[model samples]
Target: MAESTTVDIESQQAELDTYHDEPGDRPVLRARFEHNGSPRYMLYTIKRLGLDHEHGFHLDVQLVSDSLEGGVETVEAKLQEGDADLIDIDYISTARERADGAPIVAIHPYGRTVGGLVTPEDSPIEDLTDLRGRRIGVVRRLDKNWILVRAACRERHGFDPDEEATPVEAGSKVELTRMLRDGEVEGVLQFWPIVPEITETGPYREVLPMAELVQDLSETDRKLPISTFLTSEQYLSENPDAVRGFKGAYRDAVDRLTSDDELWEDIGERLMYEDDPEIVRAVRDGWREMVVADWDAETIDGMDRLFDHLLEVAGADALGVDHVPDDMFRLEV
Candidate 1:
């Protein structure tokens, strides 16, 4: 028999550390969100929110940055495919294609939606009807704000958008926006990265705020879900402790950023690392003014009303889902 060398001992230790036997010691929870500034900042800040998550587990928030390559639906598809524990997206109650028959539900709401219709400065478009027959930009189902535009066009102009409008799909946000800027598309019906908050406001002008448009079209003043955290029924059942820990820390982090402006800016910079500081500042200012830390009663009521509007847009035979998924939200840890 021979004694092992120092390098050999260290190698063995590294191997032993690779996996943990205890659930609390080294569990990793994978949460997914799109590759944009808001979710980006939230994930980055949540990572540094300090202390341990439930059962001593740590969260590994996945940034689905393939918006340009794979398209926006890729992130939601990942969740539907059972590849993640949680997802970051808007809580739009649409019986969307990929989500059919899936028990995917919204767990928490974090921020307001930033989607808007941006058009060229010199464009002649003035109303939703003007977009008819012209090529319009869309990110497919991921652009949750499209329901507003569709409802407006259908009710106000007496035209069916799905049939009347020429929708140009570019898969990714970058491409969708490029088409709009190059005049390849006449209008961009999108939000988040394409919104004026996180992007430059010089070359484009906002034709409609998604919230206002949805309100006008639906003929109701109830608020709609802008952003939310989602998870599956199985994940919640299997990882109750971890889920609670993550949610608790998340709500705490939400409250913290609202109170601490410096922390918000610092985290905002990291969240928008790819953005210009000026743009980030403008976004941060707006974010500070509206970032939601909790889902209250009025908020929940607004969401319920949103479902009603979605039903109106989708119709009985279409995609309107009445509830935000059966008992999906947990108000406390």
Candidate 2:
């Protein structure tokens, strides 16, 4: 594939408008990511520190919005349309898309970035069992978190939330948080960064971190990668060096995120939606462990087992793919 054309980060999205600016001779990897998400913390670090250039590539960061008309497209749409070179998505969603012949591949793991079941502080719902016959808010019924909840409920409590309780699809993450805050739902499964914002600022608390269930179901002591860095097969085959450069930069970014306290403070001030010191600390502490810098054969084995478990519990309809494609994961680059 040809070197991806760089978009002026300042002209693309106003929420987070900055880039490395110095491309030099490195190939450009256009990354379409969600605004104010956890991935931005690393992307920002890469741009701020010029990690991409150091690793022999230029990181051209593009922010995607929930809607397409926001000047930039959604991550999946941008990637599939070939408007962007790469993006990060949950592996399960990547499986579903690839099964539908989207031709995307998971290049590396992004660690266990799944959110937990959060409930209001005063609610009587203590555990997954208590969620029975209650309204639960989610981004969508088919979201990985909701499916995990369903599978865990069935496997652990012998009850399926989908069948026993009403799942209100709030349509988006913002609305999901609002649903829980307004008492529209007894509990909500919101993503990280946002979860800390909700739990730390008000009368909400995490009932369970989904990572525990991921460990229980995968039956691995390791925190396997749920979300992964993805790219098109064309991009990977044509620009192998660019992909390798990205992986190296990503590893460095993860290292910095792990040991850098001052960087978190900078992120809190500039990148975070809620910049409260407590929320910033919560996000930093919770996020550092969720990022997997690298993966190997053993890690792939655990991911395979996790996929089988999801297939067994969530079923094809909920998973959106009957089976994971053979070429879905391409870590070689």
Candidate 3:
């Protein structure tokens, strides 16, 4: 495949007078990311850092417009075959295990959850047990929400996902939401933001939150890993200052995301621009449930368990704990 046109930090900055910042003093950070349907909040954060043209640091973001599976394969190929300077990927658990020689820098966390229950009046599908015999529409079989939901059903509700519930796969969120509105599915399994968005649009009864089920089955400290950021190991060693600056900027973005309610509303609106106003509100509400943190021991361990479980489900070899580097969760400067 032909390589995309490269954007040089100094040259790009020099072209724009207003964006110009001291280039020599700042380090440049190059990154590539997968376009996972949702407008990524991290990208917004990166933009907010003003590193796009800063002198001491420059940040370049690229969008992988391919299928998620294809994107993953491309990322793995780039890491295994070439000498790329920077890479930022979604769903770090998979990348961390397969990165080979690349050093990874930690970033914010996000996870999957079942849609929030919306009711004309309150109903009994109050917990995982109530899901049996019900129809559930999912965006994709391999999506993280489906995995998390399957785990909850098996571990907590004692229900076999294939046996207990009807599973309908939709190609997009809009299609899935339409199914729910039409009474085609009793529940919808999706990530955080979409659940609330669907509920606000009406026709659905309620969102059966998967996180609450996980909490009930597991401990309060336990949480599932949905996604994270990473770069190559070789890049980190060669550009420690750049890595630090990126981390610092990222953490600042996380703080801003977690603290600002209006920002989330704006994000929801931006992401759900094609949807109805009610849908945007629902999306915002669902997104609010997501918790972002710098990966800690508990989070890392939780991800390890999640990967093991996923491997078991897929009937594949499990990734060893040693596969995750000591610095996998390192967020501190």
**lDDT scores in order:** 0.61, 0.82, 0.52
Name the candidate, 1 or 3, with the larger lDDT value.
1
- Write one digit per residue (lDDT tens) for candidate 3, span 239-315: 77776676566666656766676766655444343346566555545444554545676776776665555445432
Residue 277 error for model 3, in Å? 7.3
> After TM-score superposition, what is the CA distance of residue 176 in candidate 3 from its true location, in Å?
3.9
TM-score per prediction, in order, is 0.78, 0.92, 0.65
lDDT of 2 by residue, 98-177 (tens): 88888899998887989988998989999888987899998887678998988888788888788899999876676688
Model 3 alpha-carbon drift over 4 Å, by segment: 1-39, 49-56, 62-67, 70-126, 171-175, 178-186, 222-225, 261-271, 274-289, 305-333
* Model 1, CA-based lDDT: 0.61
Q: Evaluated with lDDT, which candidate comes out highest?
A: 2
Say what the RMSD of model 1 is: 8.9
Best by TM-score: 2
Per-candidate count of clashing residue pairs (backbone under 3 Å): 2, 0, 23
